[model samples]
Structure formats: C-alpha cells, structure tokens
Target: MSVSELEPGDREFERTPPHDIPAEQGVLGGMLLSQDAIAEVIEVLRTADFYRPAHQIIYDAVLDLYGRGDPADAVTIAGELTKRGEIARVGGAPYLHTLISSVPTAANAGYYARIVRERSVLRKLVETGTRIVQMGYNADGADADEILDRAQAEVFAIAEKRSGEDYVPLSEIMPGALDEIEAIGSRGGQMVGVPTGFADLDALTNGLHPGQMIVVAARPAMGKALGLSTLVPTPEGWTTMGALEVGDEVLDADGRPTRVVAATEVMHGRPCHEVEFSDGEIVVADALHQWRTSVAGVTAVRTTEEIAATLDEVHVIDGPDGRVTKIVDVRPVASVPVRCIQVDNTDHLYLVGRSRVPTHNSTLALDFARAASIRHGLTSAFFSLEMGRNEITMRLLSAEARVALHAMRSGTMQDEDWTRLARRMSEVAEAPLFIDDSPNMSMMEIRAKARRLKQQHDLRLVVIDYLQLMTSGKRVESRQVEVSEFSRSLKLLAKELQVPVIALSQLNRGPEQRTDKKPMVSDLRESGSIEQDADMVILLHREDAYEKESPRAGEADLIVAKHRNGPTATVTVAFQGHYSRFVDMAQ
Candidate 1:
C-alpha cells in the first residue's frame, strides 16, 4: 500500500507499541469484556506515539530484540510480555500474524530511527483528522487548523526535550578552573610572523599566523600577482622569488654554479657528467657516447606543461636511445615565470603590496606613501619629540619633471630634490616599497602559494596589488554573487590567518559616468559585501587626470572609503609616473 493510504495505527505499530500491563490486571475491573477489549488493546498498541516516555521504552525493547536477531512475531512478543507479567495469555495466532506482517523491516539503523522519530507527529495528525470527521466537518471542508495545532504541540514537546540547560555565567566559574592555559601550553606553542608591511597592521595581526589562508586581490593590471610574489624569500644576494631574470647559473648544494645546461639539450644526449636534481637525484650523461645513467631513474619530458599535466602520476618517459628513464621532479616548477617572490621562511620580514591601477603609478605612490606614513606616523605618534622627529619625505614627479631633474648638475639642490625624497623615505621606512605589475590570478592558486610560504617561512603580512583581476572559482547565475563570495572568502582568510590582507579593488563604472569621476564606497563593483567584509577600503582618485590642471599635474586624492577602527578622511598624495612611486605631501 502507498504510505499515505496506511492508517496511522499501522505506521506507529511498525515503529513502537504502548504499555506493558499484566494479563491478570487486563481481565479485572471490566477491562476485558469482549472481543472489543482485545481490539482496543491492539489499537492502543499500534497508535502509541513513540516520542513519549512510555512509548520510547517499548520501542527500545523492540529494537533491542531485533538487534539480538529475535523474531518480532506476536507469539514471541506475547510470551516475552507474559514472562514480564505484562499479559496473561497469548492473543489469537491469526491476529498476531497480521500485525507482524504489517510491521516494516528495519533495513538499516538510520531507517529504524527515522520511522520511530516520525511516528508521534503522524499519529497526532491522524487523531486530529478523526476528531474533525466526528465533529460534522465534511472531508472536503476539513479545518486544517486543528491538525496544525496538534502537529505543532508535538513538535514543541520534542524541541523542548532537545533544548536542555541554559548557558552558565563565566563570572560564576573559578578563574582558569578548566586549566585552559596549561592545556594550550601542553601543545607546541603557536608559530608566528607572515609579515604584511604595516607595523600597526602587524601588531594587530601577529604577522601572518600559520595554517591561515590569505587573498591578495586587485583590479586588472593593478599588480595583485606582483604583490603576492614579493612574499617569497631567498638567501642573501640571491634575487627574491619573482624577479624578471632567472640567474645565469643554478647554485649547487655548496652554493656554487656547477654548469649551465638546458633540459632539452641534456635530454638530446648532450654530455652532463654531473647533473644534480634539486631533490638530490643525480644524473651522469656521456654526450660523446650518447648514453646516460643514474641511480635514480632518469626521464626527460619535452616541456614544462607536459611535466605539469603528469605531476601527480608516476612519470616515466623514453630517453634518446629508447631506454626507460625516470624524470627528475622539480619540487616547484613554475607554470608561469615567477613574477612574484614566494617567501617560505617566517623568520625574515617580507612584504606583499598590491595596487588597483593597471599601470605602475597607482601602486607605486600609494604603496610608498602608505609605507612612509605608517612608519613616520608610528615614530611621531608613539615616541618622544626630542629624539629627533623622523619623517619620510617623498616627492612625486611626472615623467617630464624627472627628465629635467636628471639634466640638472649632479649633487645640486635641484638634482637632489628627488634623491633627497628617496633617501629620507629609505631612512624612515624599514624596507623599500616594491611595485608589482602582474595581473589576474586564480584564488585557489593564490591561497595555495600563500599557504606554502606561511609553512616554509612563517610569513608576516600579505598585500595584493588589487582585487578585480582575481578569479573566483565559482560558476554562478550572477557575476555579483560570485564576487560577493570571493570578497567574503578574502575577509575570512584574513581573520583566520590573523593577518591584515590589504587588497586593492577597482571603482565601478558609475564613477566614470559621473562628471567629477570621484570614487566612493558605493563604487565598489559587483557586491556591497566587499565594503562590509573589508577592515578598511580606500578609493584612489586623481581629479587632474580627468580634468585640466595648471601646476600640480602629479597630485591625486586618496579617499578612505571605509575604515573599521579609524576616522574616514581624504588625503592628498603626490603621484610620480617616472620613478613609479608615490610620496606624502608636505603638511
């Protein structure tokens, strides 16, 4: 029969039964009058709500017998009940068989639980329907209100049972009664320091806490990827991870160049007597004999793409003479040329800065000014004035002015204007502000690389060149939803990593539509959640770039769109195109 056609009593009987009264007591006090008395007992047993205490006990007993591989037939059950003084005699065998046949088999433990859990609600609804029928309500005009009331009452009872104790006050408990400090101290102390460039940011964030995910997002051509690259660290005198040139020589274990050999040339039987893999695999090749041997299997792949595609597999390829060879697996073979440094070590300081401007101008000046302002502001705001007020002075010059300054006499006041600015900034700030110009990167790849760096070196801070060029790995009905999820993930990563992730984002097309072209928080493209998620959001606008200017062609306004902990204000900074930098205005 269909589930809906089954009577409530039949469904409930499959799950659980009601009380276990003695058979002697059943015959006393006119309880056992006729066949109707037996029918009444059967009906009560079948329709008992399993969620009630009495019903739950009987259900548990039935389930326990089933678990023990006992048949749940009425004769077996009646005998058990008689032994417990619950029944005086076994019921008619034919009637018992009918009940047993109707009982649903508990195919799985979860299925049995669901049946028992649903019995109470189903029985109550059936009773409400019966009552409405007796009250002269036509089947077609039955009031749903009574059924709903009964169902809600059962639900409320179940909810009440599940919702146990109220919350306890912390003040009432003894201090550290649970010994939380000792428990935490028992585990290895937390690792610290994935650095983002800001000191206050670092102080609040604790320098890129381990096991944390971070996103460096930026607009198209805003150096988001370049900013992430700067986080990777290399040994002193070695170029950082993302520098343009691959050094002429690969350093050996002893930090000396063994030789310069291309992978293709080596594979084509060009002699390499001493070829060492970064992971300690050795290759010995005799170019003259066109033969090669290695303790570890040596294989050669034609391209990096081939290697990447088979990265997860056991890659073996045919060598020049059709000899089976094992390929040396580079731990990190860059899919694209490393435009950003990957800092693996947490001990040394590293900075990640991203920009929203596609060109170098937006990132350079904002980064320089930000670094300078933070450094000088910390010194001036925190320490004594008498200790010699240290300030990071910067001059933003256009391409034409830079050319004119270069033409001036060496060491002259005019020549030193830009030089002095650079020098003063260097003196005030602990590290030089570097610029990144690379574009779009997938969020998964970005998180993977950031996590790797944090594991290797304990990264302190991560800055994105910008947020717009970031690819959210989501295919949604709306681009707005995709961007919203992406923004939320970035904030969650920052909080989870306990580091300040400063991402540069683009203003919406609405700004371009306006006459002034000034940006506000509303200009945050796609999602309003971006504004909500960010600890701070800054909008970079240069009025002179859009409108005609007289003298200060290099000035730009920085609007602090949203700041969680500080006042929102607009600051004017000088933007230089030539040096690819920004400077704080002399106040």
Candidate 2:
C-alpha cells in the first residue's frame, strides 16, 4: 500500500518503515564505482543502515571485497557474493551490474551515506516510538516514570550506537605501511624521524619518537627543588587556591561547572607549592618564568634596562631534564678580523667560508670555486669567508664561458669570450644564487639568515666552504666539544630547512702525513662528531698535489668515505685550476 493512503488507525500496519531506497542504492553504487568511496561511507553507514534487505547483503559484500584489498567493481563483488552463495539472494549478476552504473560520480558518496543514515535514524525513532506506545498499553501497575525513563534511554542508545570506526583488514593496512617505509628510505632512514635540535638526544631517543610519550626526566640529581604551583583554567575563570571555598562554583579541566566540596593547600614548605583539588589534580605554574622573562611588552608596562636586559646578548640556558631562557644584558665588545666567502653580492645573508688547499691553494684562482655546487640545478647560497662577491661573479662568468679566469680578471677578454659570456649572463642572472661576504659569521647568525633566505627565495642548498672556519662565538671548556655542537647544529639546520647542507671540511694534518695523502672521515677537522652527525661525508683528494708527474694531474677524487644509508664510493671529476671550478666528465 502507498504510504500517503494510510489512515491514523491503520498507519502502523499500512505505512512503510522510514527509509529512502534510492539513497541506500546511491551510497552502494558510489562505493562500487570508486575504491576511495569505501572509506567515506564505511563509518557513516552499516549493513543495517540500508532499507532493502538485498541492498544490505550487497553492502556487506562490497565491504568484504574492500577489506581483502580487492576492487569493488560489479565483477569482483558478484564473484565474492556468489562464492558465499548470496548473489542469488541479492538479485544475482544483473543487480550487481546495475549498481555501479547508477552513479555518474562517486565523489558524492559521503553525502549519499549521510542521507541513508538520516533515514535509518528516522526508522529507528519510529521503531522506538512503537515500543514505547506498547509499553504504555501494558502499564498495568508499573511505575509510569520508570517506564518513561527506560523508553527514553533505549531511544537515546540507538543514537549512541553509531557505526564502528578504526577497523581495517591487514590487506588494506599493509600498503600504506609499505609506502611509509619507502618514504623513510628516501630520507636516508637515519634522519627519518623528527629532529630534537640535539645530536646526543637524537642518538639516544631518536628525537621525539612518534607514537610514544616524550617525558622529560632528570638523571643523577645534583640538588632538590621545591614543587611547583599551577594555574587551573576553569569555566567561571581561572581556579585559585583561596577561591575553593565550600559554596564557590568553579569549572573543571573539561570546562564543566563543578561545585567545590573541599580544597586544601598542601606541601607549603616541603619544597613544593601546590593546591590539592577535590579531583586530586594538580596544575603547574612553571610557565611564569617564560611569560615574564622572554616575552616583552605584553602588559603595557615600561620595563627599564635592568628589567628588559634583552639587548645585551641572547643566552641559551640548558638543563638535563628541561630548560628555560632569559634574554637579558646588552653590551658590545671590540671588533675582530672577519671574512666572507665570495658569490653573488645580493643583500641576502649567508654562512660563507674558504677551503684552501694545504700548500698549492693560493695562486690557483680561488674565485668561483664555490659555484660548482650550482651545477646540479640547485639554488645555492655561498657564504664567502674570504673572497669578495665581485671576484666570485667574475670567475662564474669565466667558468660558464669556459674562458680563462685570468683573461676576465685582467679585462683581456676576446670578442668570442664576450659573445659566450653574454649568452651565459642570462643564465647566471636568473639563477637562484646568493652570496654573502660577512666576516666573523657565527652559527646563530647563519641559522637566522638562512631561514630568511629560504623563506624569500625557496633556497635549496647551503654551502659552508669549510666547517673549521665556523665559530659558535662562545667560549667552552674544550674546542672539540664546541665544534661537535656546531656540527650537530648544522645537521639540525639542514633538517629544519629541508635542504641538503654541503659543508666543506678542512682535514687535519693527518692526511698530509700519510703516504697516500688521501682524506678520510677521520680527517674532518677538530670534530669526531661530524662523522656521527652527517648522513654523507665526501673528502676531496688530489693525487697531483703530492705527485705532479701523475697521469691524471687535473683529475680530482671526491671520496665518499661515509654514507649512512648506502655503500660509499668515489667519483672522479676534473678540477680546472684555470677556471677555478670542477667540471663533470659528462658535461
């Protein structure tokens, strides 16, 4: 019978249950057409959410197909249903074929699923109402209030019983896991995890490990500390120790209004200050130092030089368990001899240095030596510690045209050289290259400046000419520890900026003493930790430096002595001293 033809008395028996058959069909059709649609509708509706019993069977079959990581097209779904002897019950192959063809686009599967869910909720409401009415009829001597409460709870339970989520078969789950493994492989696996800005921490705990709690705990305590006081945020306002009177109303952490039955101030002198809540929870006021010291001009109060000593110098306060900072003091000392590397003279800041060969580096035309890093289609920043930006640009022009560096230096360029340089000028001018000749550059300065460059130019690579030339600008107990910290910081900067930092290292006297005169990972100057922190380490070795009579005098060996993810090997590239650059053999 039609639903509209039903009278009030005959409605229960004559009227159809609340449902939209087309919506159920659309949701099923959407899932069958698009493999991605299954995830959208899986949590929103269930087998029972369908109005037609046959459609429920089809939905279950589609879920089974998806769970097994199999396609949910008509053929595969029908095959699974037929294997279970349920295809006949679900209207056979023709019905399965008709399902996917019903939808032109599966993108609206979520909308269709919600419509089906709404209909299901209405049907559940009607079923609940029918049961409540029957309960009223049978309410002979039962408490009317009890019956009403039970009926209300049962109706609410239907709403609470949403379709289950967070369930997936192993077949569907394994593919994403494999994809992540491949991604980790791409990131060299050693640095696959998030960085903690500390190499020691990264080595010990893998840097704020995922799917784990990061608890800061101290080891071997030197002294004890009083407990801390905390500020509890509540609905009426922030909860206070004195405000927890018997009649006072305050909110809980969940923002629910809670009446104060009892609150006690405890451990007043026991090295800890805390207010014990009725809920047995404690709030911490450890942030008071951060709010007061680091932040400036928050409360519209004028702070004197004594209060706002931030201009003096920045301090990096460190602790075993945790740390807080205080930026106070402002004073400048005498200037020292500072040097910058040579590259483009753009106003951007850079961390530049010079890599001088042991004895023969001088008079070898050192200009444009840093520009070789830009060959691989990289937007490079060269921090020149010694060379001027003008000299570097001239060398780059010479190198691009394959002309003699001396010719360009002496303004003795020929007509052909000028023609070649004009063509290369357009290439050089538009390239994402930057040079900074700032002398006495510090690690802090490099980090701040590099972030600005990356934001402005989307910088891809940073070349620090040599690691030994860098200084933290702070005195330490030993130089080794300081260099190691700088190395770790450089590694951290690489990860933060999401770019490869190609830092040249000036090997110690060890390489010169050896008969082979080849640099190794141990030759990285002054810091053993550089080897530990670097994902890849390449050492420059020239046989001709020791033996000029060698057959490959111009050939340089780039020894990949350390590779964290793969085997190390050597690559041969020709270094033309005339052009002051390395040229790939293929080029």
For candidate 2, the clash count comes to: 21
Best by TM-score: 2
- Per-residue lDDT tens digits of candidate 1, residues 1-587? 98778899777646533222322122111111222333233333322334344333333334344435665435565555556654433333443344334324322223333344344445554554455445554445644543443344334334322211235458424434556556546645432344333334344444433333332222222111221133211222223233423333322211223322211211232322222221112222222222222322453433333443344544443322121223334222122222322222221112222211233323432342344334433111111110111111222222212432212211233555567555544444543332223234555544444444444444334555445445544446766676676677667556544445555554544555566666677877667888878766656666544433215556766565665654666666676533344455655
Encode model 2's per-residue lDDT on 365-419: one tens digit a residue. Answer: 2222233233334455776554457866776777677786656654667998888
Tell me the lDDT of model 1 at 251: 26
**lDDT values, one for every candidate:** 0.39, 0.55
